[model samples]
Target: MQITIKVLKGSDCTLEVAPTSTILEVKQQIETELQISAANQKLLLLGRPLNNEQTIASYPNIKEGTKLNLVVMKPCLRDSIQRGFRKHYPEQQAERLTNEFMTDFEKKLNEQSLDDLERFADSIVSRATT
Candidate 1:
């Protein structure tokens, strides 16, 4: 059977798949065609997320010509910050600092205070400079 996959902010693609194929298998196929990693892919059928272990046949609504939405999850903020730190610090130091920064940043975010968040960000910058 064939189905269409519409990627968010990306192009749509069609694939030939077996009814018994698992969601993970479909993701792998999408990865081959779109270059997006399976771990990052989230397939949705009518706004409901598909389970990795489930087969297409399990979803009675899914059939030939059916369209599935594909959302690609972005990398963690901590990871992006860690990469920036790696340019200036050793790997171990980068990891340690990234973890510490993310912990504090998350706490500040939870507080929902814009002024305090700005101060926290400024402190991070100052610490990085020194």
Candidate 2:
């Protein structure tokens, strides 16, 4: 069976493999073809992370012609532009976009002394209520 592998930072490539292939085996093939490390590879199956040990055949949702997207999070110059790319792809999803929208807020909070953060919040509240 044929499948399309889409690498996030790199280019997409085509592969012909059996449906019974293990997720780890597929990852190895991709790493061999792309010359990327396994640790850096993050595969999203229908927008969800795949377990390293899960087999493609085990997932009833995935079939013979399934398209797998392989995303590599190796830091790049573009990452510098965004300050942190985890915003684009959340390090954790439970927070929603609160982390992304408040990127500057987190940065400021981290940079400020604890007393400064309290004072800043106080000033904002005082001005808003007045």
Q: Which of the numbered candidates is closest to the native, going by highest TM-score?
A: 1
**Tens-place lDDT digits, model 2, residues 44-64:** 888998888877777777765
TM-score of candidate 2 to 2 decimals:
0.53
lDDT of 1: 0.94
Worst 10 residues of 1 by lDDT: 74-83
Overall lDDT per candidate, in order of appearance? 0.94, 0.73
Clashes of 2: 0
Top-lDDT candidate index: 1
- Work out the TM-score per prediction: 0.63, 0.53
Tell how far residue 58 is off in model 2, in angstroms.
0.9
Cα deviation of 57 in candidate 1 (Å)?
0.5
Question: Which parts of model 1 are misplaced by more than 4 Å?
Answer: 77-120, 123-130
lDDT of 1 at 77: 78
